[model samples]
Target: MEAAPTPTLLLAPMEGLLDFVLRDVLTRVGGVDRCVCEFIRVTGSLLPDKVFYRFIPELRNGSRTLAGVPVRAQLLGSDPSSMADNAARLAELGAEGIDLNFGCPARTVNRHGGGAAMLREPERIAAVVAAVRRAVPAHLPVSAKMRLGYDDPGSAMQCALAMQDGGACEVVVHARTKADGYRPPAYWERIAPLRQALRVPVVANGEIWNLQDAQRCRALSGGDALMLGRGMVADPGLALAIRAADAGGQGEEAPVEVRWQALAPQLARFWHLVCKDLDPPQRAGRLKQWLNLLRRRHPQAQAAFDQVRVMTDQRAITLWLQQLVAAAATADGQAPADPAA
Candidate 1:
């Protein structure tokens, strides 16, 4: 039998969690093929270019992560014209690609008629995507991501068709609907119809937290590609593991222990970036957010988070993280099972 093609692995765009700093860290870790910028809110008159830069500063750097992985700028809104206008401006600013977010389920965004809330109006999704597709250069890839639906899980097919009608080259379907709201039972099976129905590539999302989940998702969703969000955040090595599996090996080929060892410096870099952009309190909070997520996958991260969660100052938090890392690194450079491991 002919060998199966390699699956495309994308880093899902996360709002507050996966900012430029985390994007840099994850992309630099390697294996993630592409990333989407945190959803940029387009409200009222065309947002100044600076706004896109603030959310996706990599635009100024050729829309690439530090490791040169491409980063697409994602816009969120209900206005077709404004979204189209903003997409045009981003393209002008050297954005590598454009991703429209129809999958965000945050109450704040939904209240404003953006994100997953737009999924409820399939026609509007088509119109907005069509407008943006017209605005961007034909050569530049345009894509959109949405959950199954607003309240009904059955709306996925309609939403996928809307994206195709609007000229989207690819569509990612998060297995659940807006009503699901990050709940358990991600509905991976629901992506099958979207994959079968859409002429374009259908990328699966939601509930892929590990290698086992990735296998199940592909089988259930009938998709050759995946966009991982919290899965990537909680376990930074997730993309590498998934890539390993896609290549016909168990994802465990890359030892998670060594992955954590290499990841320590990246956390330090994240702290530095947070300190530079945010005040002291925000800095600690940002680090804490990552730590909390990492804790779900690594005990070392849990210990680190416990040590600094109450600390209010950036410098002190930096000192704590650095010392912990220093102690973790050994003569042979293998990660220890505790803080360093």
Candidate 2:
């Protein structure tokens, strides 16, 4: 009997939020197949190699995170020539793949005729994808991330077909229009027809927060692959939990879900990375930002957030994290971890 293929789980590129640091922590925790780096906004001139390295330090580590998951460098721009040029440079820099950004809803991006603004022009979308495809090596996959449409889903199919016509190997559709904007009740159902219409694989994104949501998303989107963003951020073990649930349903033992105790080490690891890599002024806020999101899934995170919410001193925050890690490790019956490490 033939075994089913493993579902492809991709960590989404969230500009300003899910950079290489968080990507490293999440991928290390396990079960993500690939990650797309935050979009590198390419304009008229060719960007320096340092720019790519800055956004995706993994590029220096063979375009993979420290955990060794392949990272695809994403490019966002309106000019096909410039996008193609920059993508060629990314390929030369040994990028595993190149992903286009057509889904960013930022007004600044839209005003510049980048991101979701391209959804309004299917022809332009096709051109940008085609140009980038032509520039990069054929073996290197070129993909795109897009919203359903600019304001509504009326042009969704046309835009998707444009991407296909332009030779994108895969397309990830965030199931909402630009107007919808990160609200509850993601229109997972809208992805079904796009999946049906596209020849290449269509991965569904948006609002998948847990196992039940993953199941419902698969059922509604009619696709096995998923791209996770904020949902995965809120719960670091979401991908593993989904995979375990899937395996358990197929008569395998389901491992215990990752609890806050297990997550303490990862949080400590995150703080270590933040302190080591980021600037001093940014360190405290970065920790607080993650705790703010983490509080959504774990009550322990709420306590942690409360403890650090008023703190701006890096040394003070570090001390708090060290204590937190030690307490969590003790609760789990293990030796305390070096939070500074």
Which ranges of candidate 2 are over 4 A from the true structure? 249-257, 338-341
**Model 2 lDDT, full chain set:** 0.90
Give model 1's TM-score versus the native structure.
Answer: 0.93
Residue 317, model 2: lDDT of 76
For model 1, how does the per-residue alpha-carbon lDDT over 1-341 read when each residue is reduced to its tens digit? 98866789999887778888889878877788899988888885688877888988998788898789999999999999999999999999999888999998899999989999998889999999999999999999999998999999877788889999999999988888888898998988989988888899999999888888888999999977999889888888888887777666756935553356666777877887787776665677888899898887887787778877889866687787676567656633756323221
Candidate 2 lDDT over residue span 1-341, tens digit each: 99888999999988778999999999988889999999999887799999999999998999999999999999999999999999999999999999999999999999999999999999999999999999999999999999999998989999999999999999999999998888888888999999999999999999998777888999999988999999889888888877887666542222344688877878888888998899998888888888899887888899889889999987887777778878888888899866444
Error of 2 at 49 (Å): 0.7
Looking at candidate 2, what is the lDDT of residue 176?
A: 94
- TM-score between model 2 and native: 0.96
Error of 1 at 156 (Å): 1.5
Models 1 onward score TM values of 0.93, 0.96
Model 2 / residue 228 / CA error / Å: 0.7
